[model samples]
Target: MPLDPGTPAEAPTRTAELKVRGLTKSFGRAAPVFAGISFEVPHGASVALVGANGTGKSTLLRCCLGLIPADSGEVELLGQQTGALGQGARRRLRARTGMVAQSHNLVPRLSVLSNVQHGLLGSGAGPRYWSHALAPRRAREAAMAALEEVGMADLALRRADGLSGGQSQRVAIARALVHAPRFLIADEPTASLDPAAGEEVMALFFRLVRSEGVTVVFTSHNISHALGYGDRVLGLAGGRLAIDADAAALSERDLGALYG
Candidate 1:
């Protein structure tokens, strides 16, 4: 039986939630965005991927999620090698994960509740599950519970396009969490918000994910957020992983080199 959306399933027993080895990606004939990047994120850890713009943090995150194929490398997610997974296998693997982006990515005309319910689409749910009006009572309850966790349930009936930057992000986070994912990937989650909003959102995001024991991999340009929220920080520079250290062992000064 499927677990309740409000109840995260027991995380699979895995040594590492993610492992990347010799990962490389590049456009046709151009220099590689990054090369030979390797790392391992143990289950339940939050990792911050940081670098100057164009350092391929987003590409690396996508590769890790199997959203994009790497040029030449191995990526293991949840104990399965992504490259070796066939389409059906990959889809099943991805169903166990969730993602958020800077753009919010909400369907503008949709209600916030509907947007969050969309998270269940990965479950191969039927069209009735796609809209709040037609969604099963259980699906609506689950989505509402997710929004409540993000402090956005009160706005459930509002159109997503009508929300503020911060509110939209909360809705996005709710959508990501609605399916009770064991692994969460976020790219520049706070990039679109103002400083104060960004800080608050980051705090809430980590708190909820941590409470649920979700393993998180996120990218951030905000050094403070990276250091404050990450258990480990990784900096990419010059097509390589230039910094990989426990967040407690590093500070802003340690990450400045990636930007220089």
Candidate 2:
């Protein structure tokens, strides 16, 4: 379908899908980072965007999330054209999306529950008036439930800064889910964790996809993880999409080319 410029919130179609068509981006007069980048993530699918460092994987994600404007092309989330929306409309759309980054992006001093509750801020249900006080009972309850999903509910009272790297990543995952977003974007979510921890986190992501039907688009440099966990794998090289294929069908040689 051609991308529509209006809000999809009122559209009768399912509001849990993402589609990009001819997406192009560039930093300056240089050639575009990606051109004619097109893909569709159906509801509840888990896809990986794989590439070497500096291949514009992160940039593509940021552009999809409206963090940066695309020089041209279409980004349709659910059914709305994201690139054509105003700030208010974009913010409304973002409330339905969740993102996890390698850095965790937590406030060090806050308790895990508090950090998770911040996810509700975008939805206007957060305790923004009393910044120093605890989140309201209902918000805390929801945050705790989200933490439980990531197996971090037991550590909800701990300061975010005190947690181990794996635990912190779990907390970040919980924060992302607290809003009950329809789409999740994770950028190198397990980059700082050990092998076991990475596996655990990826398993949790699979569980979410199966149980909650959340659509996930994540970037990863780990070929094994991409093959093991992703339904589809997209390869970016030299600032463009070089390959798009089923993860189960790709050979090691194909991945080697992406890295080389």
44, model 2: CA deviation in Å? 1.1
Candidate 1: residue pairs that collide:
none
Q: What tens digits encode model 2's per-residue C-alpha lDDT throughout 98-198?
A: 99999998889988888888888888664551232555677878888998888888888888899998999888888888888988899999999999989
| Candidate 1 residue runs with Cα over 4 Å from true position | 1-14
Model 1's TM-score against the true structure: 0.94
Candidate 1, residues 1-260, lDDT tens digits: the string is 88899998886774798999999999899999999999999989999999999999999999999999999999999989999999889988988999999999999998999999999988777788778999999999999999989999899999999999999999999999998999999999999999999999999999999999999999999999899999999999999999999999998999987888
Q: What is the alpha-carbon lDDT for the whole of candidate 1?
A: 0.94
lDDT of 1 at 174: 94
Q: List per-candidate RMSD values in Å.
A: 7.3, 7.1
Candidate 2 displacement at residue 56 in angstroms: 0.4
- Candidate 2 wrongly placed segments (more than 4 Å): 1-16, 126-132
- Worst window of 10 by summed lDDT in candidate 2: 126-135
